[model samples]
Target: MIKKLAIDDLRPGMEVVQMSSSLWEHLPNLYTQPGPIKSEAHLKLMREQGYQHAFVEVEVPGEPLEKRLDAILADRMKDAPIKERVPFDKEIEVADRAYKSAMNHAHRLINDAKMGRKVDFEGTVETVDGIVNSAVRNPDTLLCLSKLAQYDDYTYGHCINVSAIAVVFGEFLGLSRDELTRLGVAGMMHDLGKTAVPERIINKRARLSSAEFEEIKRHPQYGYDILKRQGDVPEDVLEAVRDHHEKFNGKGYPANRHRSDTSALARIISLADVYDALTSDRSYKDAILPNKALAIMYGMRDQAFDPLEVQLFIKCLGIFPSGSLVKLSTGFYGVVYESNPNLPLMPKIKIILDQDLRPIPSELVDLAARQAVGDENLEILECADPTDYRINLKPYLTRTR
Candidate 1:
């Protein structure tokens, strides 16, 4: 008989069988090789493959594994109450308020540009400056900004993404707080010229005709003019906004030159803009996966992006960004809610469904430590698309009052 060991008792010599809702597997980790299982399916697949010595985690009442997982959760909750373990409610409230405020401000700023009436462009800059300054001082604010993507409009969404990316990029590049705020301003304003474009062209759902494209291309110039007219905006800010699209490969429009000619802020903004745009759904295509987008950026290194900057961007955003949906080997899907900064890829996931894609009572899985404990048998099959899963996370993550 295989000896049963508590997860904490798992060490580098014990053998056990692991099972979950959709999987069963055998692993040496329970006794010999110690590590958390990487995914849900590994347990089941290993079991099917004839491995007998494995330990698996399941929620079934009365099962030894279920009891183990429950004991672990109970112990964890006892040590750090559920309120502290996952403060999703409080965080969501803060995020919702910030997003709404930023959306209103962004929409007004864009509308102001559409009307050709100079609203306080400087004020928009000031707001970005304030946000960046706060984020630099308190990293948690960065988490709040990530939630801004929940808003739908491109203008507001892009602004929030830009601001967040700029702050992160600034941190990566070791820029001072003052410089970070300025870089963020440049990012937020990089597409300011879009406001001058005709709404039909701006909001066109289809590919632009050449004439329309050419007209659209003029927005950079339009943005530069707008900034120049705005009293006393820094020259660097104007340059970054106007030149972000101009690539080093001379392939980008408006002025195709090597990225070496671009200002540092422009270089940083260029990478951020492309990453956000690629990860976001556009008129032409649905949003691509962030990892896939990062791979594409790697392909464009040196030609379209600064190679170092691209690497840094990946480092900053991690293998899986927050808010992404992922799949476990068990075939269940979950949304990534929080990631420990040190381990950007593995985060605390709130699983809403089980393998085979059936809704279940929800639970949080801390992929980093839970799987690694005694289940090398577990593994991630692949990333799942949350949009396809019909996951409405707001209700679970948010508190109305």
Candidate 2:
């Protein structure tokens, strides 16, 4: 059987069946195929490359590896603090309203920009205000709802998602209310330049030729131009739209401005922008799981993004962010319901399957709780793909609190 094993428990005899996720694209030299563990040196190299777990073939097991991992997790979670969460139903209600409002505003803004009409700055502020309120009330709700990536328009959905994410991250950073509003506006309008690009180029399913790629890269400047013409837009908002694609190491596009040249708002929006794009399903490629996206972003720290900002982003989202599908130590499948930043690894989960892999009535589980019914030793074994099990998480996730 394919079992998920922690890096520390790996032995030379075991065969690696799969990587925890397809992150090798970011680290080209990292080995990703199924292979026999060569030596402790190999394990060391994998750890150095940021791999924490892998799926391996196990033949000589005393107890199931899942149970063993769960026991370890439960032990570690004994002292984890249990914080009360916003009721799921209430959060879903708020998220639904915010998402619809953002989507409507994004569609209008994009269409208006395409027609050379000035964007409604007051309308943008009002939309962002609602997003900021939802984020400050309970960031996880909108964040979790954002994971429902079955949208008709990628651009609109992406802008809304990025805006919600930026607001949450801004709040986490202790930005003033005014600052959060600006960050939200920046995120909502960061991709406005894409509207100026040809529809064919924007939705192309294949790699772009050099000339086409260059045209695509002009989006930051294009977005800046569009927003700047509005006249009343904030300077910080314009800078954020223009510099969101710039890298911290001076390697990013357009002006190639580096580090201190980029404003703090732009840096924050940049992380959110890339993160939402990576996790959202697109016409060209499948979306990576949230945990995997975070890992890839972590690997890109100091290269594509600011290291401290990346770390803070991960901290803000927690280890297993909302919408992650995980297999519990008790041999059940569940969706991450909420994250406890203080106890990231032990966030609350909503159990959907029982140990036998049979469908069961959903139940909320808090891994940080001192005592859980039926399975006191419950713990997450590893992340699982909802597609693999043909599970539809939308109903469960969007249900009323």
Candidate 3:
């Protein structure tokens, strides 16, 4: 049987396949070079090398891939039909409040850093903890808030979104709450050094002069310095705060640490920071479609991000992420309000545009359920930028209890 085996769980004789997800179980037999794990020594070597998990053909019998996640994450995965897992509607209100609070805190911290006021690392604990709890309860709700809730200031909003994304991705990776908290804090503070950079260069719409760009490159060190002055923060969080910009290829700034040298939390935050930055609307550019951003990141793997981490991140968020405007096979336009991580290609999109691509009343369609019922005609044809259609996903994302 094909199974998703964590590095620690890999035993001798299991053939490792390069498939996605720790949402693992029995998947299709994909022979990505048919390398069965050799022995206990090899497994130890793999773990020592920082391998997370592997898709492998093993002797153990297991549930099908699609069936396993629903059972394991019944209380955690987005929209798993389990009653104990609070519905997204009930959870989203609390999530929205948490997001706003985190943004407000981010704004204050960044401004304090600018004014040379000492940062109270303790101040961030509550907000980060709230986000982690929500992620543990309903990751999709926290992610939707990240997707839809935009603060007036980009700097603050970006910080909070990165934090939220990191928490959700960390949960998918099976990180403990304490580990997620540190990762979330790292994501929130990663760009605090940008506060030191002159506002003109940071917000410039035109190409930056080489000297100006060099100054921009120093933000990592500047961030490290700012956080170092304020003691009591965890060392790992501080390291991630400084190294989130480091490239997987050892080409990134400050320390220029190789991918293997970087902490896992930093790597997780790096993926979140880049994805949020790419998909976000900025003074420098318009937001790219989620699909486009994912495609770009996929190509940059090993060069920009850890190759396996990138693949897993893409798997967790899905090809068409929540809040994405998408098109269906029936010639309708919709916003993806929720993603199915196990089957990322399918999501529950709220249809709001008709066959003629004109505005229509909202109608939510769960593509997975439709497909499960053999409704082959209903499927996502493509993902699009919501800005292109002037579609506001907020209204469609809410549902009456």
Best by lDDT: 2
TM-score of 1: 0.69
| Full candidate order by TM-score, most accurate first | 3, 2, 1
lDDT of 1 by residue, 1-401 (tens): 12233444334333333221121123343322234554446455544554444332222224322223334333432222111232554445554555566667678767776777665544455456555544544333354355324767767788767776777666644465555666777777778898888889988888799999998888877888887776445677788888888886878867775665667778778888888888776667788877788889988888888666676666656566556667876777766666554565566676767787777777777777875797544445566665676665555445222
lDDT for each residue of candidate 2 in 62-165, tens digit (9 for 90 to 100): 64222343353344334433435567667777777878888888888888899988776656776788888877777787778788645788888998888889
For candidate 2, the per-residue lDDT at 349 reads 90
Query: Where does model 1 exceed 4 Å of error?
Result: 1-92, 137-148, 340-344, 356-362, 371-374, 399-401
Note the Cα lDDT for every prediction shown: 0.62, 0.78, 0.76
Q: Model 3's lDDT to the true fold?
A: 0.76
How high a TM-score does candidate 2 get? 0.76
Better candidate by TM-score, 2 or 3: 3
Measured against the true structure, the TM-scores of the candidates, in listed sequence, are: 0.69, 0.76, 0.77
Ranking by lDDT: 2, 3, 1
* Model 2 weakest 10-residue run by lDDT: 64-73
lDDT of 2: 0.78
Alpha-carbon shift of residue 314 in model 1 (angstroms) = 0.9
